[model samples]
Target: MQNNPKIVLLNGYGPISINNELLELYPVTTSHGAIGFPLKSLRAENVTIVTNLINFWSLTKKMKPENMCYLYAYGGLEDEDMEKIKATSIKST
Candidate 1:
């Protein structure tokens, strides 16, 4: 496994792009019920996640600084929670 996989944390609906590459989308699942792990735990490699702000909060709380996050969704996290995450913004053309 790559020690530093490109991890993208998406906010909002639809696809999220970082730098110039569009991340592969992964939907949040509940069909199997709550798993015994954080969402990040499930991803061993680079992954792009399509999730709500709630899940995004949980993920960032324990996220490593090396990971890259793209926030497009609004609400859920507080100012302090936001501090924990090292967020990257989309540049306007």
Candidate 2:
């Protein structure tokens, strides 16, 4: 299709839009499902996702910096989990 794909997804609020183009829109089988494998496989420069909270957290925990993310989820992530993930995630690289 000439128009960009209309991605129906669960999350990726901040990783999908870099230079105004959507590089990828990863799907989630469920709220807690991971997107790392799918995202990495796409080799995307940017991504936008609309999913549940758990999907956002899990994918954010593993995304690469070059692959910017834009994730949107209802309700915010738990403070403790986000803290731990931010400290431990290698996404900065």
Candidate 3:
């Protein structure tokens, strides 16, 4: 048997809704809204949500569910920020 990874991607600007049994990744709206992805639909041992830092902070403020994993990424880094990051060297032991 093999185990695969389940990941949900969100833009962080769209609205998210959570009901009794499901969590909508992106809820539909009247003006330019994205389709929702029900959490219940994914049948996996582990589910990871990938989003920007700002959205991660927002989600934490609302609710921090147990066993839920989140991976935050830098969506848009300025030129200076990119340069700084590029200058930073990593050392592996």
Candidate 4:
């Protein structure tokens, strides 16, 4: 992995561009009730987002900078998603 933090966007649809910057898209298994896991193990300081709370906690604990792991709300997520982003935007002192 590169020095830059790894960004994993789970369950995202359409394009892989966030804010016009293209990011690597990793496909995860969402079938058979399997929890989403990256193809390989993630190192510390990596970032990830998942819709399931269980996966959120799992990633948060596994990845350094726990705040980088987030819970994504699907459908009608405009406000709720913003709140989650803002909450995790800055790490508290």
Best by TM-score: 2
RMSD of each: 12.7, 14.1, 15.4, 13.4
Clashes in each model (backbone N, CA, C under 3 Å)?
2, 19, 0, 0
lDDT of 3 at 62: 53
User: For candidate 1, lDDT tens digit of each residue in 27-91?
Assistant: 32212211121122222122333246455556534544333332422333344433333334422
**In model 3, which regions exceed 4 Å deviation?**
1-45, 75-93
Per-residue C-alpha lDDT of model 3 across residues 1-93, encoded as one tens digit per residue: 742222233222222232233333322222222223322222222233433555554554454343332323234323432222211121111
Question: Each candidate's TM vs. the true structure?
Answer: 0.24, 0.27, 0.26, 0.25
Query: Considering summed lDDT, which 10 consecutive residues are worst modelled in model 2?
Result: 84-93
Which segments of candidate 1 are over 4 A away from where they belong? 1-47, 72-93
Candidate 4 lDDT, 3-93, residue by residue in tens: 3222333432112333334333322222221233322222222234455545644552353322232323333234333333322132211
Of 2 and 4, the candidate ahead on lDDT is: 2
Candidate 1 local Cα displacement, residue 78, angstroms: 26
Q: Candidate 1: TM-score?
A: 0.24
Clashes by residue pair, model 1: 11-73, 12-73
Off by over 4 Å in 4: 1-47, 66-69, 72-76, 79-93
lDDT of each: 0.33, 0.36, 0.31, 0.32
Q: What are the per-residue Cα lDDT tens digits for candidate 2 across 1-93? A: 342222222334233432343434344323444433211112234434434555555665665544344444234333432332221122321
Q: Which stretches of candidate 2 lie over 4 Å from their true place?
A: 1-45, 73-93
